[model samples]
Target: MNETELASYWNNNAPAWIELSRAGYDIYRDYLNTPAFFTILPDVKGLKGIDIGCGEGHNTRLLATKGAIVDAIDISSLFIESAIKMEKEYPLGIRYTVASATKLPFNNDSFDFATSFMCLMDLPDQEQAVSEAYRVLKPGGFFQFSIEHPCFKTPYQRKVENAQGDIAFEVGNYFKSANGTIEEWIFGDAPDELKNRLPKFRIPNFHRTLSWWINTLISVGFSIELLHEPYPDEEAVLNKPKLKAAREISYFLQVRCRK
Candidate 1:
């Protein structure tokens, strides 16, 4: 799907998906419990922050609770509305706006910190987003983000159990170029009858190597401060046997960079 189609799809579906499943809240909670999240964002008190691609404003609320003046933006109007409603109840003083990540509406040097969670890969014009991040952040401000681990988490792979009942995962083309194609599944809480009603959309998602990400940050006038490959916690391992096994092999990368 094109950018407009993608935006429309998310705008139409995000409210129900987030409210019904509380996926956004759960994700934010998981981030809070992870070592990578705390380590990447130490001492955020009283800072001016912006969360680009802030879906339901979970991270923005978290930042505000930590004393940051947060402005959260998303392309989806439905998402912004839901976030705004939540903000009213929570009263974190978070400002919600409907804006594109690639074309942020903020002025240059307007923020002391910026964050994007699980959003960079989904963007069709990630270069523009990176540039806008660099433009908005003040010199020496931090721009941190987390994305799916490109090396081992391709969409084609699925978990399986061996004869001994040990969980195992099978993945292909670890060294595939960033432009490699893979099928993605968009599963949520839609009813079985409505499942087929929703279209399966296909779009390009670039998978950059670790070095490529570092170089891109450097080219955008930013320097990498931390890079983490976070593993699932012990409890998650016990409950999610397959994910637990995947954690042993390292499955996610979190990056912190300074502009």
Candidate 2:
């Protein structure tokens, strides 16, 4: 699919996504990926930052809470509207706009830092998005982003339960690159009571290899600073058993690169 088509899919999925994610249903993000992402994130106090694919501005607000001047953008207008509504109510001084990450609206050297939380995989042109981030960041600025682990979360993934009810995750298509593939599902960790009442989110996933991501950043003039594979700890697994798979194999990958 084209960028416009990808945006249209996100627009359709935005309401359900915002509602569920705000209600604490996105457990992988809340319990595993996001916490680890912030653990390694550098201080952003008094810095100017842009959050690409801000998604109702959750992580963007976190940046604001850390004393950064944050401007956020998402291609889905509905998502941007919800983010703006929350910003107005909370008064975090964040600027939320509807824009694509592949073609950012900012000029060169516009930001001290940039971020995208669990969003790069959903973008149509991953290379261009990374390039835009590199373009907007000033020298010595960094862009930190997280996404599902490319090796583990592929186009073909299956959860198999044995007779003992032990779950095993199977992944294939690691070498394959998908343009835009529709993946219709709700947050797996959400309580059954709430999940039964909500419609599944229709997310358009674009899959690329881990090497592709690394090479793209390097090609865009970003020096790789850190690579993190976030998995749940034992305490987290005890609290959320659904995350046990992540303990065995990482669920998310976070990268920090300097321009």
Candidate 3:
């Protein structure tokens, strides 16, 4: 699918995503992935930043709270609308725009740093998105991003429960790259009462190998600085037992690179 078609899928997903995520149904993100991203993130005090593919601006608001002047963009106008509404109510001083990551609407060297939270894997053209991020960053600026771990979250993934009731993931297709593959599912941790009522979010899965991501960043003039594989901790598993699977296999990958 093209970028326009992909945006529609996310636009459709925006309402449920905003509701469920705000209600704390996206446990892995709120509990593990995002916390890990911020744990390793360098201080952004007084820095200018852009958050590409910033869904509903939750993480973008977090960046703003960290003392960064932030510009956040999402391809889906609906997502941008929700983000802008929150910005208006909360007044975080974030500039939210409806734009594509592949074609950033900004001048060269426009930001001190950049970020994308669990978004690159959904873009149709990952390389161009990375290049646009490079184009917008000032000298020595770093771009930090997080995505579903390619090695573990692949085109073929199955939940395996052993006789002992231990949950594990059986994943394959690491060598395969999926473009705009429609994945229909709701957050596993969502309350069963609410899950039955909620529409399954239709997300476009664009899968690429670990090497492809690293090489693409390097090709776009970003020097690899830090690589992180984040999984939920024991305390998190206690709150949400489904997160135990993440402890067994990596669920998210965070990368930081310099321009």
RMSD, each candidate, Å?
Answer: 3.6, 1.3, 0.9
Residue 65 shift from truth in candidate 3, angstroms: 0.6
TM-score of every model versus the real structure = 0.82, 0.96, 0.98
Candidate 1: stretches off by over 4 Å? 23-35, 174-204, 239-242
Residue pairs with backbone overlap in model 2: none
- How far residue 47's Cα lies from its native spot in candidate 3, in Å, is 0.2
lDDT of 1 by residue, 1-259 (tens): 4567668766766745565436432432353223466666868898999998888876677778889989999988888998999988879889999989988898999999998877787776667788899999999899988876776666456778779877767877555544424344443333555446554434345666556667778888888888877767677656544345545455666788888
Better of 1 and 2 by TM-score: 2
Q: Please name the candidate that would achieve the greatest lDDT relative to the true structure.
A: 3
lDDT by residue for model 3 (31-103), tens:
8999999999999999999999999999999999999999999999999999999999999899999999999
Q: For candidate 2, lDDT tens digit of each residue in 1-259?
A: 7878888888888887888899887888888888999899999999999999998888889889999999999999999999999998999899998999988999999999999999999887889999999999999999999998899899899978789867788899899887778888999867788678878888888899999999999998999999999878899989988888777777889999999
- The most accurate candidate by TM-score is 3
* Candidate 3 residue spans exceeding 4 A from truth: none
lDDT of each: 0.72, 0.90, 0.93
